[model samples]
Target chain A: MRREGSAFQGVGAVFIKELSDNISSVRMLMLELLIVLTAMAALYEAIIALRQNTAEDPFLLLRLFTVSQAPLPSFVAVLGFLIPLMAIGLGFDLINSEHNRRTLSRILAQPIYRDALLLGKYLAGLATIAISLTALWLLVIGLGLIFLGVPPGGEEIARSLAFLVIAIFYAGVWLSLAMLLSIVFRSPATAALVALGIWLFLTVLWPMLAPAFAQMISPPDPRYAALGLDTPDTAIWTQLLQRFSPNDLFGEAMLAVLSPTTRTLGPVFLDQLRGAVMGAPLPFGESVMIAWPQTVGLIACTIVLFVAGYILFQRQEVRA
Target chain B: MSDQKPEGGAASPDVVIAARDLTKRYGKTSVVDAINFDIAKGEVFGLLGPNGAGKTTTILMMLGLTEISAGRVSVLGFDPARSPLQVKRRVGYLPDAVGFYDHLTAVENLAYAAKLMGLSMAERSQRIVAALSRVRLLDVANKRVATFSRGMRQRLGLAEVIVKRAEIAILDEPTSGLDPQATLEFLDLIRELKAEGVSVLLSSHMLDQVQRVCDRVALFRTGKIVMMGSVAELAVQVLGAGFVVEVEADGAGIARRLAAIPGVGNVETLAEDRFRMTADRDVRPDAARAVVAANGALRRLSVDEPSLEAIYAHYFQASQSGGVRDAA
Candidate 1:
């Protein structure tokens, strides 16, 4: 009877078991629902504020819902930061905890391949993030309709969904990174620390420090520096520094979300400074393409890290 | 048990698991080196050794968890290195210090393992019940494993492995933490599997348990199998050459006189008036007559064959000396 099923069916069975086990836990369900509810409330309050104001600018509401009159940069900024933490939190102990429980070898002894174990964990983590983010997005859209007197247009909906995908992929990258660390390190606490440290370096410290470090170490060649203090060369160097960070990719993604017209940094920054910001909304597809390089880089890194982890785990002896 | 002969041979069935010149090295030190042996189908094979004697390393190589540095291993007609999934599917393993999800109930843990083994919902439920019942833990199937006692967890671990009805069960110290009663029950469960034609390769430090259950045992020391064969066979071939004679004699006075005899190797006073005489040859008759002639009345007379424990000690001593000789 066991021989009748395909390999993928076996993998799917394990994946579903892991997913159900994770979601069925009271603590995990409460934590995820709380996050979704908080994001919904925040989105609803912004939409309500926009509706009460009688502003003439057509984008006054969009800007208010996204960027302007907020506690921080934008809704995207909050999501960009919070989503990765959620991803890491969900996956940091996925593999190591199995080892700790002494069930890793027992599970591997079954017919399932090592790939199944890793893929099951990855899918479970991604599914949790997707479900939470979807719930939040739906609530926000529902609130937007209730408060703003109308539903989002086709382009607005597409742009918001695109942002959500970017957020999901960003979270997935962190999840893979955390799982890789979990396999490499023995202790769950240590794995979490390593994952959080990488997150902090990429999101907070790298953006601030990479530019300074590049300037100090290899300040644009004097020949290029002398042409102008703030030429395209300087902007190129700054962007190059920003390119080293996943957060910069997220920040660019957020900019594309809040003001659709702001696709490229040169035009976006120039328009913002000159107070000549075009009212034309950028297409969601174009915005995603602009962040495609960082997205690809992060996704590729995730694959490499996870494959290394898989190999290490396959080679590790479960003696203890 | 049905006396069906395996396809290979009756004396030594086709090797279900074979390791030849197998070696595993961690960096500079070899944990298992050139260890050669075979395990036959339906036989309860034991890998017996003291701690750090490479028993676990050999098992890990068989499971393909640890890469072999040299030599080769074939498990059930599949190369463990190349076809690990195939080999693993046919083998159930309980690692040392078996641990399961503390948050999950025993039934859930077994069901998860069964699903991993590709069992359907109905099959999983039936197998889980059967396995738990075999391990005598069906009553606590619904309770979370975190609250289980050590012995209960061990039993649950056993249930998880057998739930799939794997062809070969590899257990590493399955009864290490079990109490005497649990150990006996676990041995009975193993015996049941043997009756059902399932092969078992158990590694353990508990020599007495291994001696009782294993049809054959491989004694490992310092990364190699120094001795390997059936316990009865080994005792007969190695220690069986000598006979132990217990007789009521004049304590140390008779013991010293027996030691001086031509064929007798040594004699020690066991109790108040009894003496145990070990002879290089079968000199029990002559020694008994000698004791009777020397003002001694034989209260009890018996010629004893060497036991598994004595053979184990003998082989370990020989292996240690062999290792030292090789070093020199």
Candidate 2:
């Protein structure tokens, strides 16, 4: 083994080791098995709905695979809520568990940088989520084609793929955040709880409270506000308040993906088709770009948290 | 490996690790204060000390695992603080408690470590087998570590450290939890490491093990090396010219006469006839003549050098009485 090998190879090695270990874990296998069984049940239910003709929309059958999405908003809301929890669970203990096993010192004694450990664990988590999500997506699409007697149109296919990527990136953001938490906290249990608490706060409670909290903190004036005219001052303040929540960014990305008419408030890429054009739906690549800033922001936040954790880990004394 | 001479020195034997003024402090208290030492290639160097004596702290600094408050450390010609990656590549460290994934088998644990060390597939297999064999754990290589006894875990820990064939091995209390048989086996493996010219720094409170395996030992007390030298040299220094002479005297009056001798400091009667005397130097001949002149019979004359345990006790007592001043 020459020392001249690229440092990325070290990260690749760790990634492979983590991925193999994850697949071999009984707990992970059980979870995947349960997911597969659930998908089968959902498929059977979708087929029954299609045969009965009681269901007005056939696309509503996809809801059986996950939660009920009778209202379109409910579908977005359910996925938005569930994805972060899964992400947090997948990555909450990746680093701290190694520390608990006392293998951290030994692994670090190798000739690789500390960044490799963080990046490898992140990549492994991302890969696992991607594979699992892709499998489920294919299973649902397969069931849809067979039961509904309708192969998804190109637009629907495009939307599903776009949704899958968004879901993955959403999960990835949480995974990275959880990994960062794992590095910051010494105990795996504490890291998991903190990550879960953060997930619940952001996905469930924060959105519910943000508007009320914003109104209370910065009340709108009744005199001019009653004129039914929107003020730039109030609009800027509201936008600032909304940015405080990660859900807003995720919601914007989801809206851009699900609704053909919706466009993100940014300069449209003239060279490339921006958002989903009426006739020519948004391609997967174009969709990713529209959501690019949010993805990058989430990824950057993950990196910053991880970098801080890495610095702390490097400085920690491995006494026992 | 080629035998190239190290720069800035004669083609002397390779010194795998060296520390000059190596110091570590925790806030106001200095744990390891300005200690100078060098580990010669292939020698088993022991840092012998009581608890709270900063042995572990010193080892951590050498491994680049702890921040050095002051001083310099070089392992395998690489400065630990500046070039930690290079230092880590050539060094294998076994911390005090050798914890591992209990669910993983011995072979799996070693394989994981080997992979982390970037060993190739063929090299990993070879090294894993060799390490397991070296530690005498080859039979239980497939057994999960959770099922292993403490002694077995210690052996596995040793196996992991040597799996990389590192040039310098830093083991902190490597055999602390082992039984006599396992301890001996572990010592034998250490001896083998010495034969391969791998420098080993073993931190232990086991005086007997240190005496047997270490060529040179440093006795640390209150975050400082109170005494350091080869075992023989230490024995010579602590024991000095020594012997005790006990004479069977007539009565208390004769004991007084023996004490009155210019060379003898204090005298006491052991029984109805026997008396003991303390001498500042080897005054055996003079004391014997004096006893004879007083018609006292010499019952026993023996030379007693202080044991390593006694030397350790004496130095610790001296250090305490010296008002716990910091050591250089």
Candidate 3:
């Protein structure tokens, strides 16, 4: 049957309500505090480490994000690990909490379609992540200015802002995955645990497993092996397998944006590097071009996960 | 058992809700089988049955919260399945064990609902205040719902309906968990909604509670409504004018003597002496005379007004015992 009215009739209302709820929630507070503290520590270590190598490097400010001292990862690395945790924390209980509280039917009984509730929640979660990430980005840059005593180039600001946006998309991928679990499971705790477990597997284990799976799928050429050269086919296969994990896509995108000196994210033949300055930083546009595919991958994964959750939630019974 | 159409057709302006042969099936099992009913504006219509008897399923179908396997339901001249937003905009629902955001204050909770209803900010606060006051929760308007008792939460649920200014209110087991005192207060609030000309559809397993507040009720068994009508009408149909005279007296063969009364149809022995007679008319005086003539000492004599509880029991009992008269 064709349902009457716009499916998005009350989306704004749900969005505003969910946004406020996410912002004021105790879970959000704890996640924000954790991210802020770790980010500050990473920033401090990056500045101390960068002080020893103040030279003709024009991208010193960019190095503040990627440079790390022993015993602590860089700021971008810390974000790569913590962003998914924050997104999952905000979203794992989104739907099931309503079920547990017996509020799903009442809320759905309002003058809105199921589309409004799911979309509103996803947008609100993304917005919350965006706000927190932007704040942390500003804090890091402001601290870098005070500690490093150097102003970032206009291109550097643009790249980091793009990084902030991509980080939000990265957070979106995890948020949608968490929401899917929330719709699939009736218990919030179960959803949370399963989301965390998936995060651990994708971020920690998948990187290690990707190479083995790739070698099994595409063995290196014996001629290339005898020549003491890595097979391009196995290298391509590994990157393809690794891209399945959102962490890999986000990590590569962060590398391209923060470390402009990175010329290529995949295998580059000798012919492609004919006239390239080995360690020279690529232009901002070239760097974004390199990260563009990964950025799109993050967004596409988020939409796919979100649509899957929407379908499940639409079919789910309202009675608890 | 019967899907009698209301006197007027679906075009009748006064019929706020009309369902014809509405059915809900999950796989081969039908949770709600073909059923029909119409609720007039301002009528308190109750769906009464035991747990798992499809009352909640029927209610969900009415709101278009669940898909209907067959037939049609129209709420306020719109098919609930096709125009759910229109139906929902005009109808308010309070689910069994209604919940609110525990961290938000009562006013804040209602304000969210108000926004969903598209109420302007000025009107939102005004309606919220009026609604909270109507449900007697105004003093706790700013208090978080976590501190609320079950009864308080129920009243807050009602407050949400009031804030919406809905034309019809669907309540599923509204008084299930409330204490007797709070239940009475909630019923009174339902009556107040009726007095203000809002139609109500209430579903519950508690026969006595429905009997008090509902103007008409549908008695559900399994997936179908076995009987539907006013309490007095059901009593007459199921109980044969539905009068019961109880005689608590001591004597020999008093049961047989009471059964011999002219208007009495069935005589049940409560004990060696006490007898309960289902009669077409008030037979208390005749029962006492019969007991006396049987050399029974009449200690007590009274008429037990036929209630919905009795009708439900009688309908289910007769059907279960292979008695086909009432079932037919």
lDDT of each: 0.75, 0.72, 0.90
The residue-level lDDT of candidate 2 at B72 comes to 79
Interface RMSD, all candidates in order, equals: 5.7, 4.3, 4.0
- Give a tens-digit lDDT track for model 3, residues B184-288: 999999999999999999998888999999999999888898899988789889878778788899989888888888868999888876788888777888887
Question: Which ranges of candidate 2 are over 4 A from the true structure?
Answer: A1-9, A30-76, A221-243, A264-290, B1-12, B26-29, B239-306, B324-328
Error of 3 at B214 (Å): 1.6
Docking class of 1: acceptable
Best by DockQ: 3
lDDT at position B326, candidate 3:
44
How big a share of the true inter-chain contacts is recovered in candidate 3?
A: 0.85
Task: Name the DockQ score for candidate 2.
Answer: 0.39
List candidate 3 stretches off by more than 4 Å: A221-228, B1-11, B245-302, B323-328
When sorted by TM-score, best at the front, the candidate numbers are 3, 1, 2
1 or 2, which is superior by lDDT? 1
- Per-model RMSD to reference: 5.7, 6.3, 4.8
Tens-digit lDDT track of model 2 for B1-328: 1122234332235777777788998888898999887778888899989888999888878776778998776677666666666777788888776787887799988887788787899999998998898888999999989999878888787887788778888888888878899889888888988888888899999888877788889988778887788765665566541334566645336777777777565777788777777654556677677767776666665544325676677666776777656542
Residue-level lDDT tens digits of model 1 in A35-153: 66656556655665676776654444344337434553455666776777788888889888888888887777777666688888788878978888887778667766776766567
